[model samples]
Target: MLIVFGLMIAGGALLGGEGDSADNKSDTSAATKSGSSSDSKLKDNYHVGSVANHKGYKFKVNKVTYYDGSDFDKPKKGNRYVICNVTIKNDTDKKQSYNPMDFQLNANGNSTNMMEILTKENYSQNTLDSGDLDPGASVTGNLIGQANKNANLKLEYQPSVWNDETVKVSLY
Candidate 1:
């Protein structure tokens, strides 16, 4: 009876190890409700001009431009306007919604929401707006935000409003 009990325990331990290994493997591809583990580890950081995929949309930051606020539309006391020229492509089978509010500028560990600076003549015509995009279509526009005057910035894209998953794009 003692030998039989030992074998049973050993068998249970082996099975438990297998289950743990399977869970670790799934961690690399599984989408967690809080946040994606593989996504945060691998696909989170992107450089300018590099494409990042989230959900079914492909996003790329073509360029980043900083501007001093005009007299009429000045940034908050210690902030400057950041304009990101980005292109988002819908790669899914159905239509997707794109909005400027989905993008956030991070600087000095603070997240800055996108601002609509339509008063800027240069960006007024090319400003990014909220709309639904059809599959196979792409939209390019400038997403504006306010950041610290001398802070390093990272642009973060939140693909879904319901989920907290975000992809970070390095602006500099």
Candidate 2:
């Protein structure tokens, strides 16, 4: 009886160990498959009102508006405010962070972050803010930047800090 019990314990450990390794392998493979599939779906350029997916988040640049700035808060000479009304939806099972800083304006070989100064404007309440989004949650707001008045502008969204993949949106 004791011999049978010892053998049963040994067999269980071997089976359990193998099962765990199999589970780990499957998890890794699944992640790889999903990542590859999503990467393939990424496009070269997106336009206003178009949807772009990054990882598990859905982003849309709903509208782009230009501001010459108010009396007290004027843009630099030859520069104007570029405001993108963006919407981000968290499709992942876990919570994610959404910030205006993640959006950048690219023009004339220069990349600039959101213009935080506009956040102090009276219309600032409509500007984007850094916040946490739970699964299925969404946030929509403006990302304000300053760029040359006549420069061709492009907006880039870097969704993940771990990866350098970006979603580009043309603002013609």
The TM-scores of all predictions, comma-separated, are 0.71, 0.74
Q: For model 1, where is the 10-residue window of minimal lDDT?
A: 33-42
* Tens digits of per-residue lDDT for model 1, 4-95: 99999999999999999999878855646436434523375899999877555788999998887887888889988888999999988888
Candidate 1 off by > 4 Å = 1-42, 161-163
Alpha-carbon shift of residue 41 in model 1 (angstroms): 8.3
Please name the candidate that would achieve the greatest lDDT relative to the true structure: 2
lDDT of 2 by residue, 80-102 (tens): 88888899999889899877878
Going through the candidates in the order shown, the clash numbers are 0, 0
Please give the CA lDDT of all the candidate structures: 0.83, 0.84
